[model samples]
Target: MCFLFLFSLPIDTSDRQKSLPYGTDPEYFKMPTRQHLQASSSSKVNTSAKYHEKDDISSDIDNELSVIFRTLQDLRNLKENSTVSPRTEQKSASEKLLKITELQAAIGDLKRRNAKQRIVKMPQKQN
Candidate 1:
């Protein structure tokens, strides 16, 4: 069991030099050191200036939104002012209804006159 465990452990490659087919050293495959890893992880990036620039744009966006909302309100007011009053609409609707009823009565009179026509059959000559 101990021999199997020892064989399963990874072999150290400190003394061995890995050569490439082009005879160039592998610079990209070097393992990172503790100091290099810590230096990369501890670096602080300052973004306050970028955030302030975005804040200025946010204020401009808010101003534009307010202008759009005000324009919408003005359009609503204009539409309400240009529309006809309820009393005028009611009068026009009643006039249309009266015209429709008169047309329906005229149609009924024509239908009755059409029904009164007799279908006369002519006598055929003997062949």
Candidate 2:
């Protein structure tokens, strides 16, 4: 049994070297240095900055949407209020309609901007 075990062991060092994926080079598994760590951290910071920017844009959209809702509510109130003269109500309604259209255009512009930013940030898949 001892003789069989001895014969089974690899007699050539070249065979061991050949088995290593990186050819036994110590550099292949070297620990990351400070520069590499800093670089990675900087990338993380930039990623976070992008997230903050996106959050800001989202908040702006929310604000615009809230303003639009308020405008619509005002229009409804104007319709219900019998005290207001027809001419004044019509003028207010037209003004509110114009404001709504402007808000819609602004929201559309924001959406397009957000979409563009997303496309720019997306990583390209390598073939």
Candidate 3:
């Protein structure tokens, strides 16, 4: 039984020396150098700046939407309260409504574009 067990053991011991620490690959334990750290930090800053810019743009869009909503409410009130109006006033109100609707559509398109850009900018994780 002792002889059989001894025979079952690996005969070659050279492979042991080549084996990495903790039985894993060396690349997994790679240490980041100064240049790599610096580069990564700089990229983080750039990413942060981009995020801030996006936030600013988003806030601006929100503000514009709020203003447009208020204007629409006021227009509705005007249309409801006034029983009679001149032809020019009615035409102008219709034009304002059309312009506001167009602006809303444009803002919607911008929001979609920004969302797409955000998705594209996100990094994929490696297994």
Candidate 4:
């Protein structure tokens, strides 16, 4: 009975632990040294800053956005102040109009091709 009682008690770490061992758990050591997280009456810094602080965007991100904005402005200026002769503009416009007309004609041709047609055929099997 004494031998059974002595042997029944846990001998080593693996025999004792179910999920975690005796020394492996952080809470065991932390509980003794840890102070209460309750807010103090005269705290200088915010306590929430310890856990839930918002991350600041790096200066590199700001610089990248400024560069992208400058590039967009430059492209807008180029589009607004296009340098082309009046004759050249007229020629391009006429070419675009000709292309549009060709597209419209092609659409009409497709519509004609797709027009429904009736077909006469023998009756299907009666069975």
Candidate 5:
């Protein structure tokens, strides 16, 4: 009974298949080997490197776009200020000119009234 049980133990056939050339059998396709693992790992490294470059480029583009937007906003503000500034300055200048003209007219009127009020004294006989 002992010998029968020993002979009936399951045999490991994996060592026998290792001796065959790679890809010679269809069943080995499902199993992964060291070379396959290394190849996949190397490909992953290359893909990660490319991804890092893509991320850097995207970040640079985002920064540039933000800068462009800020510049455009500043330009718009400058345009608005430029358009409004001249009108306000012209209005203020006209107001000051009007005030000066009014003052001049009032002064001339006062001078004319004073000139008309001057009294002439009669010449007295010399004794």
Candidate 6:
């Protein structure tokens, strides 16, 4: 049958001893998950057990991160309605628009300190 399925495919080295290591087979580097994985002969991912893959976001990038938090709370309420109107900051175009409203209120205080930062990822135990 097609020359016994082409002589049953490559099948050599005593039908791959106990798998793994069709490459640097020194008894698959003393296996215990290749005791101390010494990568060299051309790597293929294992950079410290790789895993830091979080960035999906699409739901239209979560409604564009809530329209960039409603355009930084409408430019901090248009810089507190230009410091409650009744202007007169003796021009220089009102001190360069009050230094662009103190740099947009320090970028709305770093988006309110990164909107209360939090990160959690857990899951790893395949030993």
**Model 3: runs farther than 4 Å from truth?**
1-59, 80-86
Worst 10 residues of 2 by lDDT: 55-64
Q: Choose the strongest candidate by lDDT.
A: 2
Q: Which residue runs does candidate 4 get wrong by more than 4 Å?
A: 1-81, 116-127
Tens-digit lDDT track of model 3 for 1-127: 9999998997787886577677687777779999999999999999999986875553455767687677778766764436556887778778887978887787787687678668868999899
State the TM-score for model 3.
0.36
Model 1 regions lying over 4 Å from their true place: 1-82, 118-127
Residue-wise lDDT of candidate 2 within 1-127, one digit each (tens)?
A: 9999999997888876556675567566678999999999999999999986875554465677687778777767754467989998888778988977887887787787778778878999999
lDDT of 6 at 34: 54
Instruction: Return the lDDT, model 1, position 43.
Output: 58
Worst 10 residues of 1 by lDDT: 113-122
lDDT values for all models: 0.58, 0.78, 0.76, 0.52, 0.63, 0.53
lDDT of 3 at 35: 100
lDDT of 2: 0.78
Which of candidates 1 and 3 reaches a greater lDDT?
Answer: 3
**C-alpha RMSD between model 4 and the true structure:** 24.4
Q: Say which prediction, candidate 1 or candidate 5, comes out ahead on lDDT.
A: 5
Best by TM-score: 2
What stretches of model 6 exceed 4 Å from their correct place?
1-34, 38-57, 76-127
Error of 3 at 47 (Å): 23
Query: Root-mean-square deviation of each candidate, in angstroms?
Result: 33.6, 18.2, 16.7, 24.4, 37.2, 16.8
Deviation in Å, model 1, residue 2 alpha carbon = 99
| Model 5 residue 51 CA deviation in Å | 98
lDDT (10s digit) by residue, model 4, range 8-97: 997777744455554676576454422354335224356556432432212344454465566546544544226988887787668656
lDDT of 1 by residue, 32-123 (tens): 99998877666532366665454443234345446556654654454233488999777766865675576566556445444433222345
Clashing residue pairs, backbone N/CA/C < 3 A, model 6: none
